[model samples]
Target: MKIGKVLIANRGEIALRIHRACQEMGIRTVAVHSTADAAAMHVRLADESVCIGPPPARESYLNVAAILSAAAITGADAIHPGYGFLSENANFAEMVEAHGFVFIGPRPEHIRMMGDKIAAKDAMRRLGVPLVPGSLGALASLEEARQVAAEVMYPVLIKAAAGGGGRGMKVAQDESGLEEAWRVARTEAKAAFGDDAVYLEKYLDRPRHIELQVLADTHGHVVHFGERDCSLQRRHQKLVEEAGSPVLDAAQRDALGAQVTRALKQLGYRNAGTLEFLWQDGQFAFIEMNTRLQVEHPVTEMVCGIDLVKEQLRVAAGERLGYGQSEIRFQGHAIECRITAENPDTFLPSPGRVTTYHAPGGLGVRVDSALYSGYAVPPHYDSLIAKLVVHGGTRAEAIARLRRSLAEMVVDGIETTLPLHLAIMEDPEFQAGDYTIHWLEQFVARRNPAR
Candidate 1:
């Protein structure tokens, strides 16, 4: 494979992460930044930089033409979309290819199929992948949804087919809830993703949000690295993640991993992708596929000792995968806590300047962030400030290390979820890995007694 220049089409920590990988590969990098990220760490460290557009995302990171122009002007051969923005936008992927730049991810068709939740579920079902019982297609009317819910049984989950990041998701326990859920879900879906299409599924109560990380090349070779348990969450957002989910046994892991691998190979998947599953009562059901790298990727990387971003670059360059499933091995356990700028309880975006910043450092501790002392936390983008990842020989050790790391981490001048994370570490349910998706809600309730 010919190694050349690559363009990073995102900002902040992820952009820097890709840049570091490209640098290691001795490849030149072009960092595209919005007006808000002009002085970001990624922009300053890149081999070259381009101002894509203004502070807003639609006019900037999601602007296909501007990103293509940047790649063309910078002489970049590939464009790497780091996780969000237009990362999984099939239209943008096609545009990149049309402009003679390789997209460092799955093919355009895969993105389109997975971008729509309903379509992705259909594809999974076709490949014999386990999916929750619910409407096979979009519910055209409230009556239709009610009928499907009756068959699949409630409480059913109403999700925007074209939405992600927990933006357009709700629970409808019965027929009455289904009617109002459809309208509200569609409204939020259209506003967030410009697509109001939605689908319903049986919402498994107290399911662990486990996901398998898979890598594939154009050579038809695909393998699951491992699974990450992201059950500890708030409002459908993951707060803490760990590799080799304590919830799954060896036989269960192999079964779920093999199923996901078969589905990916059948679909001709390539590059880096994640198959999300809702695990409950020892049964795994496919939720969706993220056709881009994930935020919790570092946890898997830490355990597997692999540079996923570098592999993405290699695969996009038409190179075959370096390691097969048998060659990959999962070592010790690893955990990652997403330190974000938000109200501990309300979970509202709390962006502001970092009057003082201190990132924890020591053995077995890794901090992936773009924050620095006195740097302003721009309100123009996601609130994620840093990821505190730690590895240990055992799950208990990893938890202890994570607790210490979070305590040592300091980011002043903005209210963050640090306190909440601390509380989580101290929670007995969390310490024992006995919590589920709704654990945070229950924990908060206990933190504040009834008025």
Candidate 2:
């Protein structure tokens, strides 16, 4: 099960990240790209490259057949679907194994189970994981939703059973709003996920989005890598992420990590996974689990001193997790800002040729990006262009380092969220770590007023 050659069935910064890890492991990489990414960084750095399809994701990155064919032709021993695209697609995982290539992720059943929010919650409950109080399954009718909402109290959230990214989610303040919320949620869910099934959960007034990173191997060993505070979000999309949350102590981290590892062990999970939770009033409630590597994994790696991608490769190659939970240490504080090609104020996509590109450098600073001076920022992919990460001995020092790094970063010829991140770093409330998931929206509103 040695992964000598890997086909990276992804693009952009994550694809480059995986390529670096493979190179470090002495593994050859085959970059699969669309025609639009012919000059991308990962493609240029890879041992070999293959054109998958056109710019649109459906005809290219998401095309399972094209990716499998590329792997077969390249003689790749495995396929690494980095983070997005087919990363969490259970069928794609199965297809990879069926084609005699390793899938560097969890079992297909784990991916399929976690993809369904209701099924995931149920499994978590069975495995003794804490969950937000709500319906045990999808509501069959509006009447059923009403009963569940009444039982859980008002201001309940109507969420699509198979949704993410706040797509099929709505809030009902009271009974008067329940019917509309239900209808809209179902409609959105059907359009987005092709599944009209919706569920209800009691919405917390103010909750911090915290997630635990866990790694498991073919062996029964499972360990958690503390937590990340991803509360600085807009419309449920995280912009800033911090590892070893400012509010959590070592005791709390250990307790939650123990619980997560135990639960994942019971489920027989494997590879790298993240368990997302809502933290409010000192209690953690499981929301969902991502069966692949997360975008903000660098922060965890910085604090834990572990290479998650390398560990993923090792575990996928049937290697044991030689270390255990006790050996894993949470060191200093780390923060990551997701820099996207968009308007700083309006959040509109800004895609064009980059005239200049310069990433910051110094102690404990890492820039994960595929952007270059003359490259064209394609509009076909995610808006995220780079991740600016910084680490320090303390949270205050981390903030100071992040500020300096932000000032040093230069991405010209296109609007990016760099200005927005700089403002966030300067905000007193953010510096004090006194914000929740709603804080970003309010901060943006206060800054704009017109919008």
Candidate 3:
């Protein structure tokens, strides 16, 4: 089950991260790209490169057939589908396995179950995981939606059953707002995921987003690398992520981590995944499980001293998880600020060639990027072009380190969200770790009134 070559079916920083991991493991790498990503850093660095399709993601990154063909032609034994695109596609995973190539991710059934919100919640509920009170399945109609809202109380959330990432989600403050929310959620769900099925959930006001990083192998061994506080988000997209939540103590952290590990092992999940939760008042309510490596994985890696992608490679290659629960250790605090190619004030995508770029240095500062001075930020993809992660002995020290590193980071010739990140680093509530999911939106509205 040894994988000698890995075909990375992604672009940008994550692809580069995978390439580096493969190279360090003495594995050859192949990069698949779109026309727009012809000059992507990952492609330039990979041992072999292939043009998958056009600039559009549907024909390029999301084209599972093209990705498989690239792997087949390039003689790669494994394919790493990074987060987003087809990373969570169950059919794609099945196809990769059918084609005799290992998909460096969870089992196909695991991906399928987690891709559906209703199914994922039902499974978690059966595992005795804490869930926000709501329907156990998709709402039958507006009548069912109202009934569930009555049972769950007001301020219920209507969420799409098939996809996540903030799409097809609407909150109804009361019964009067239920019908419109349901309709709008269905419409958005169909447009985004091609699935109009929606579910209801009790909406917790300003709950903090917490996720545990779980690693497992085919040997039925699973372990957790503590928790990450991803409360600093904008419109459900994480902007700032920190390891070792400031709120949870040792007892709570261990209990929750053990709970997640047990649940994942029960399902026989493999490779790396994340169990997201809504935390408030020391209680955790299950959100949804992400069946792929998260964009904020660097924080967990920095704190735990684990190369998660390397572990994923081993797990997918049928090797046992060599470390037990106690073997994993958490070090000092770490924080990650996602640097996107967007207007700082308006948050609009600003894709163009970077004229000048300089990375921050010194101890505990790591930059995962695909950007160079001449690299062009493509307009056809996600705005996130780089991630700036910093580590320190204490949370306060991490914050201080992040501020200094951010100040030293320079990306010229295009607007970026660096200004917003700078503002967040200086925010009082942010520094105190007293904010919630909705805090970022309010913070921006108050200060950046024009946008």
Task: Highest lDDT: give the candidate number.
Answer: 2
Using Cα atoms with residue i matched to residue i, what is each candidate's TM-score against the true structure? Answer: 0.97, 0.99, 0.99
Question: Candidate 2 has what TM-score?
Answer: 0.99
| Regions more than 4 Å wrong, model 2 | none
Which segments of candidate 1 are over 4 A away from where they belong? Answer: 448-451
What digit string (tens of lDDT, one per residue) describes model 3 on residues 1-451? 8999999989899999999999999999999999999999999999999999999999999998899999999999999999998999999999999999999999999999998888999999988889888998998899999988999899999999996789999999999899999999999999998999999999999799999999899999999999999998888899999998988888999999888889888988899999999998889999899999999999999998899999999999999988799988889999999999999888888999999999999999999999999898989999998899999999999999999988999999889998889889998888998888899899989888776
Better candidate number, 2 or 3, judged by TM-score? 2
Candidate numbers, best lDDT first, in rank order: 2, 3, 1
1-451, model 1: which lDDT tens digit per residue? 5769999999989999999999999999999999888778999999999998999998998888898998998899898999988888899999998888898999999999998889999999999998988889888887788888898898998889887778888888877788788888989999998988888889888888999999999999999889999988877778889998988776787788888888789899999999998989888889899999999999999999999999998899899987778898888999998989998877789988889999988888999999887788899888998989999998899888888988898999999998888888877778888988888778877875661
Q: Among these predicted structures, which one has the highest TM-score? A: 2
Local error of candidate 2 at residue 122 (angstroms): 0.2
User: Candidate 3: misplaced stretches above 4 Å?
Assistant: none
Q: Model 2 over residues 368-426: C-alpha lDDT tens digits?
A: 99999999999999999999999999999999999999999999999999999999999
Model 2 residue 296 CA deviation in Å = 0.1
lDDT of 3: 0.93
Model 1 quality (TM-score)? 0.97
